[model samples]
Target: MSQTPLLPSRREFIKQGAAAAATFMIVPRFVLGGKGYTAPSDQLVIAGVGVGGKGESDLASFAKTGKVRIGYLCDVDDRRAAKSRQAFPQAKYYKDWRQLLDKESKNFDAVSVATPDHNHAAVTLAAMQLGKHVYVQKPLTHDLYEARALTEAAKRYPVVTQMGNQGASGDGVRQLQEWYDANLIGKVHTVYCWTDRPVWPQGIPWPTGATSVPPELDWDLWLGTAPFRPYVDKLVPFNWRGWWEYGTGALGDMGCHLLEAPFRVLGLQYASTVQASVGSVYVDEFKRGYFPESCPPSSHVTLTFPATKKNKQEVTVHWMDGGIQPERPEELGPNELFGDGGNGILFVGKKGKMMASTYAANPRLLPLSHNQEVKVKPTLARVPGGAEGHYAQWVEACIAGHGNHTVSAPFETAGPLTEALLMANLAIRGYDLRRPKTTGPGFDYPGRGIELVWDPQQLRVTNFEEVNRFVKRDYRPGWQ
Candidate 1:
């Protein structure tokens, strides 16, 4: 199941598109006039899928490398893609990624996917199968099975791949790792990662008003892989993050950024056991609302990870969202800011505590002044420009070819990281699974009040079979 092959294999596609690729070629940088300029063939040609929102900035960052060419732009909504299309006027445009890959797969050397979490694996897997390097946005995929599949596919395909968790390249995480290594913070047993997210609405009933689909947006194409649903107002652009159909909720939206620090600091992997509790919403005084279609308003999840080489004892990581945060350490001054004031990660070690803001930025020891008392020397080499260099890092790696270069969050790393987070997501969704009671007027919450035991190799919850359906969702017909 981890090695599900896409429709067209690399060898077959290469032979099929050989003729179309041979006739046309872009003018080389040198041909356009400049001494000591690299040839166009040396540049990495990338196809931009989902060229809107973050996709626009991702393309801009990739182009900044001076070693990449945005050769193609693909998006379902032309209005959302207008900025990117105008920025890269010379790039070919397409409404469907399949058509772009079918006709121009041979032309581009790589593909950058910044689509919603649901479409990440679809575009990424196809690109990898075609022998193209890929850079996908964070959280890697929408489900655990997809993350696992992409991981195995990365090994099978000889191409460079990266996840857009730029913080993995930041110096702060490396600093935290060094502190742990030097024993300045003793042995970390617990970590608290919190965020004030879900800025969009959640825990609300789905909108039911009948509305017309916008002319510029291909509603059917946008709903690729996900079940067919009527277009809800404001669901596009951003609000989709709160809905399970299209996004991974708050954890998916910010987990990659917050969790990267601890994963790097302790060399964490799969979680052994997981449990979660979510906040409730009420439609009126009489009853609490039950809107399973949307993610809960907020959640606090606890995951237990077995001991690793970096840490001797097993670790417990807590994920808090929707303005929830752990108690402030008494070592710090009361008025001092806590975790960039809104979003932050706290590592509690036997001897001391260390924390950082989102993206693992601004690392400092507890008590603020204790940072001055610490004397851990820098050991890990830093990425150029830190977090900002993530884009160019992947570009240079693609230029250097698969194993020849290093990417901060390659599938090898991002895959497992994403899987663990998605595993936690199961607990969140499971907490809401409902069934009719044998002889009652209400539903039985069987998935609640339980700790989900995970079998990573099998990719399922050992104790709860019902939640496994979410591990690997079925793609809509014609999509798979």
Candidate 2:
């Protein structure tokens, strides 16, 4: 108490800490274990290409797993990629993704494709061909054909694959399915799903601008495989979500989340019939632009699933988007259910019903009274488990090599989900101007509400030749 030693000044302390951090950064890493991390003989070297936006979060999550060391980072904009590079100082950096893939593929065990929707197939397919495990962001593929092709490619390459729909791993989503299977929601005859998106740029026609390009951006490379077009400020970075050529609209963006539980719970493989009613809330232009070129401002898509001989209850799914929602079910009390912002799937059963959001920690349902007398098995897992983190789950799966496994949202599950999601767009495109409320169960059509029977084995329509034409797409020359 008689003598007090003076502490280092803030600048002095920071300088010393900086030196220590620099020294620690160069040190050899080791495996983290309870007994104290021992150095590993081998570590999975990983590389991330699109290192900003959603990609940055993916990179950080992967880095935290400790199974892999980030060896390279790539992006078109150096400014965007800088933070991720500093986050992993040991990693090399590149502006061009192809250079990263071609030259550095040997250095990496896996590569993540977090680029735009249009470039997903090109980058991910190249990585797969290079024998790297690919973690691609969802809508998985841009169009129906790419969906089928990517699924086939995954089969050919013997590597772990995961879609970036993190909601797939949510215990809440799994519990939602389990609840449905156990008849807690009875037989779900109808599902209403919606997404509130395009917060960046939406509800307008593609901008008309002079073609003078920005120096910072490589517009040609940005276009990638899509049919060539001049650079527009409205269609870059984040706003791509609103463009048809670049992004897949709100339905494509959030459908994977909202539709995931309903699609899984009911085993909905393909829709027999799909139709749409669009308003300009305008239907004519929904599918025309970068986002909703021909899509309506507000549209409702109705999907009909035929009742197989084994199960007679016909399943019907309806998608409502553009900040629109169907009238709340009258059976449920007023304010018992609220629909606004983002997405939710309502499973309407013969008995009780349940509604849950994809990312919801605790998805609650209507009437509150349904909770009484119902005994849920309590098999549901808490939200944040050790392996439940999307990146962590994939890392754990990769380490085990072979064991009891789940693909989170595997291609098999995602295939029909994509089909139905895309069908919402299709219904929007096939909208009839005269028939405003024409898209629904038991509507007037040649096939009643069922358009074409789905042949799961063949992965195509078994009947209705005209409708089958839309199930596939013709790629533009070199792009395919």
Candidate 3:
């Protein structure tokens, strides 16, 4: 099928006309012509779908790349998306992302997907299939199926793809990755990652309002492939991250960032088997529909990794959210102690331990201390400017295909990482889960936790038959 064509709006035309007038009216001698110089060969056009919130920041950075031009802007909520148009007045705006792709396909060489988790795969898949490079926000997919699908599609398309785990490129992250490689943290067996997210619009009760939809919001488009539901303001613009239908709750929201370091350093993929344990502080929160009743409040999710060909030892990566953290590692020092609402990832190897945040700028590394002493090294390996540099690297790759670190979290690597986290998510949806066996390729539930052997091919639990329904979603009529 032919892709959508760009429809130039009257506002956009006027904006462009004004820009032309300014460019002509302003004299170059006084305006500093050097800064606005455009390379003759540099012409990589890009579009941002969902250009508000974080998307706004992404658009600004991409615009600074100089080699790329922001050609299209898309968002379902027109009111919220207004700032995007003002930020990049030259770019065209669209209420429906599909229409942006269909009409403006040829206008952009690549597409940046900054939509909610539910719409990531649909928009990314459509753009990638049409031979457009995609920079999708993490976690890459809404479900295990979408993760695998995105992985396959990436292989099929010859395009430069990157997941927006910006910290993956940070100096601290790279240093952490290097430490793992050098065996500074030897034979890493366990990892603890946490984040205090949904910090913005979290703990929202189930939305109860009139069925009437807002004039500015294309309710159906916003819902995208998720199930049909009445219009609710709580789910629009930004709050969707706390809901099951729109977002992946806290796990899906921050897992990619918290786990990126471990996954990248260890090349971790989907868990061999997965299980989760839930601890609810308030029962009424679940009953009264405070927060997404479908998701858990506080939970401990454990993923067991099988022995790989290279690293012939299995590993376990644990995830904690909603103010839960792992038992403080014995190596952490008095000053190095993590505080409340801390976001960091710990890489505990047989030798040493290291932990860092999303930016990975200031990592706390522990020496080989038996008594669990926190010793901050005076000088450590430095990672130059992390994601800021990574962004530039991608732009260079997109244009010249020449850069030192070109493997910027492409789908091949991102898919497995996303799938692993999704497994944790599935474990949550599978009711109260239990820990897997201390040893084995399968999961073992103790008392309350349910043991569900994951089948990657079928995308379901082998023994627990009920989870198959949550494997994928049925989109609304027109959306599908």
Top lDDT model = 1
lDDT of 1 at 184: 84
Q: What TM value does model 2 have? A: 0.79
> Model 3: per-residue lDDT, tens digit, 171-262?
76766665566566677788888866656454445757676778888887888898777787556676777677778878888888888877
Residues 1-480, model 1: lDDT tens digits: 334552346787576445535533445557566788787776899999999999999999999888889999999999999999999999999999999999998789999999988999999988887778999998899989889888988887778999999999999999999888999889999999999998999999999899999999999999989999988888897888888888999999899999999998999988999999999899999889999889888999999999999898999999999899999999878789899988999999999999999999999998788888768779999999899999889998987767999889999989989987898889999999999999969789998979999998888899988888889888999888
C-alpha TM-score for every candidate:
0.94, 0.79, 0.81
The C-alpha stretches of model 3 lying farther than 4 A from their native spots are: 1-41, 200-205, 281-293, 339-341, 367-384, 401-405, 432-448
C-alpha local distance difference test of each model: 0.90, 0.65, 0.71
Show the lowest summed lDDT stretch of 10 residues, model 1: 17-26
lDDT of 2 by residue, 1-480 (tens): 011112234575455334223422333444344345545524556778788887888888887877778888888766567789789888998777788876876667677778887787777766765666777777877766567657766665555678878777777676676677676667777878876554555557777868676676777767777777777774667888766666777777888877877666677666776666655533266643223353345667788876643225788888877777766766567655554335666778888777776453355556556566566785655435522587777766555432335557655566567767776665554342123246665333333243445554454545544444444544445655
Query: Largest TM-score belongs to which candidate?
Result: 1
Q: Which ranges of candidate 1 are over 4 A from the true structure?
A: 1-37
RMSD to truth, every model: 3.1, 14.1, 9.2
TM-score of candidate 3 on Cα atoms, chains taken together: 0.81
Give the lowest summed-lDDT range of ten residues in model 2.
Answer: 1-10
